[model samples]
Target: MTTNTPLIELTAWMRGRLAERVARLIDAGHDPHTGPDLIITPLGTTGEPGTRADRSCDRCGRFVSQGCILYMITVQAAPRVLCVGGLCGACRRLEDGWQA
Candidate 1:
């Protein structure tokens, strides 16, 4: 269980960062949601991770082709909310349902 502490921390940190960015964009009257469209497609229900050429996992910086599973991570820092995708399978496994 202790092994997952770092991953949980990293996930929280990433979410906080993303939330801040989204909040800033919203305050500036810009639509932050549309920005991810060019980088990711709508979340799929194929029960398997999708592939994206030339893209690296947002968490571990690994190539998606290297068995990385894409995920739509929800970021909520306050009134701002958004979802960011891209996390490797290894990292996801390490999480093991311990995500907050």
Candidate 2:
């Protein structure tokens, strides 16, 4: 639990990032809202201490060779949604999981 960093600011930042991420998905011919969550885990960032999660679409699930987008959903903890595209990807041999 990293202290000294406010949670609100983190969440707000996450929201903005998430918004952009979803937008990028739309640009890449994918539905942001429809993408299924591929992974969920507590974020371990040094500064951005929030909930970092992973998600992907059907095609992305197969085509994506890296890890799922390293995104943080802090709406409940903070107030924003942060999603970084091309951040992470999923693994096929891992059995329904990502290595973010």
lDDT of 1 by residue, 1-100 (tens): 0111223444564655565566666787766444433222221122244444335555566666544345535433333233445556665654344433
lDDT of 1: 0.46
What is the lDDT of every predicted structure here?
A: 0.46, 0.33
* lDDT of candidate 1 at residue 10, scale 0 to 100: 44
lDDT of 2 at 68: 36
Error of 2 at 90 (Å): 28
Q: Which stretch of 10 consecutive residues in model 2 shows the poorest summed lDDT?
A: 38-47
Off-target runs (Cα >4 Å) in candidate 2 are 1-10, 35-100
